[model samples]
Target: MITVDFSRLTVSPGDRILDIGCGSGRHTCAAYRLKGVRVTGADLNPEDLKEARGRLTFHDQLGEHGGGAWNLSAADVTRLPFPDACFDLVVCSEVLEHIPDHDTAMGEIVRVLKPGKPLVVSVPRYLPERICWALSDEYFNANQGHVRIYRKSDLIARLERAGTRFLEHHYAHGIHAPYWWLKCFVGPTRTDSPAVNLYHRLLTWDIMKKPRITRFLDRLLNPVLGKSLVLYLIKRRL
Candidate 1:
């Protein structure tokens, strides 16, 4: 689901990009594959950074998985190590809600991105996230997991206040809302449960094969039931 929409974050060769909360390096890998853009994937957790580095261009076909041309850094989003205006693209997918200091993070994101370039911010949609929180204490109670939820408008308002002049916005991953609800209802960590296991298998199949039946269904249902809201913003040129 992410890969499809993420392709729109296009870049030319040598374009510098930053994956500020690059968990698992999915977006970072894709950027390398599509263009020879220099990318830095940064995260606060050393463990996630290590795992993300290992998967980057490791053992995949030569032409597959973004060609492994990326640098991984252990760093915090609120305080980036790089200088100002260092990247043409910045992506903070599924990471903002976890930070209690979202404003600081937003400031850093804008600071690093070259003015007029695009920033893609993705968060769990309000309704789907609320459902998960309502269903289970473990969802947000983990403390290490999501700390807050975001509405598209709320997020946009923050970016605007931070001086990021966004030009457009949209929602994505509508197919995932139910899968998470199922997990929350069954048990977020209890993938072993019969119902949970079945649902996981179905989701895996759906992503891999992308059957036409489900494709059309998701297109129809996404506006109402999408799991993630993707906000595409641009930093006004100085």
Candidate 2:
């Protein structure tokens, strides 16, 4: 479920981490568990934010999830409520493609991150996403689901224009692409379909159990047919 591997990404204890557009606070939970990070979960969905906060609180009391040290806030990514150079690490996974003013949002992220801090961004890869779009009209038509599709080269070009210097990029979640194509073929919102249901169960198991066989297959398949392309970036200190 994690796109940015914190260990490989150079995240350290005590770093102040920001998760912009943090739906359900998956990143926040992980950050909190990373030794001594000060994690903040920011999102536009008050309902989701509230639910995420409740989940964190429950886990903390249960001696699980983060062990009681993370923050949650509801805010627009374009107009973040943090001061300049406030965060040591920033995560904007699967968010930029949805925003019409992605430049502004990127600027806000850069403004808040300290120099040399890497920002991780993830978006659906062009081919897989385009296939989904071709498979169903409902896939990209939902109001806030996804506003734009991104090709890797085009996305990197965009980041360059937005003032984010891309350092590296990699693909992930290859196993989820075909499942989504199936969903789009059936119906984007219709999760009750037998096919979708089956795939959902498989994905849940893959995420939770991470069976060795499936993980190996996913790794081999990821580069060629990955669903998401994750890019690492650094905000230039000028």
Candidate 3:
């Protein structure tokens, strides 16, 4: 599922877009479908890169608006391989919390982005994430799992320190918070449980069908219990 809103980001044809830490390529796929932009998915995991590559054959399936080239690379966010100021847009969704030296990573993101271009960053919102931490230590301690919980203000302050101009922020995935709470209660790995399985089905259906009921409910609940906090930041011209 994509966290960053393309409309809010205002992606244009021919913009170069990068999705850093692009696990499984959900947002990468979204960026590729934007008409005429060039999209790249970079990740630390080869398997997820493979999944992204394999999924490209289906880009034609994304329809007329799906009109962009896709590139996949394995790279460290703190040490990106691209030349400076090359990308028009960069997405760092659900990634900062996983890095121990996120400040360095954020600096690298600013370096690669064109001056005045926006970087879309997202993390688990404080309250929902705090609940998850309270529910299970295993949740945050797993390998490659989240290492920090971010308050919105703290995250904004961090971006400012990284030399980006703060633009705006929003909450997302309100419907998924309860699903995670249920998982934490049962066991993070207990997908076999009936409740968890049923909720997964609901999420899958919502993704595929986009039925009105759940959409309405999710929009209504987003401000109160949203699972992710999304930030928009612009690189300052040197």
What is the C-alpha local distance difference test score of each model? 0.79, 0.83, 0.89
Put down candidate 3 lDDT per residue, 119-227, tens digits, no spaces.
9999999999999889977788652589899999998898888878999888999999999988888888765899999999999999999999999998999999999
Worst 10 residues of 2 by lDDT: 60-69
* TM-score, predicted candidate 1 vs. hidden true structure: 0.91
For each candidate, what TM-score against the reference?
Answer: 0.91, 0.93, 0.96
Residue 113, model 1, lDDT: 89
Off by over 4 Å in 3: 61-65
- Kindly list the per-residue Cα lDDT of model 2 for residues 45-140, writing each as its tens digit: 998899879867866877664333688888899999989899988999889888998878888887899987888888888999889989988887
lDDT of 2 at 95: 91
Model 3 RMSD in Å is 1.4
Report the error of model 1 at residue 188, Å.
2.2
TM-score of 2: 0.93
Better of 1 and 2 by TM-score: 2
Top TM-score prediction, candidate number: 3
* Candidate 2 regions with alpha-carbon error over 4 angstroms: 65-68
Best by lDDT: 3
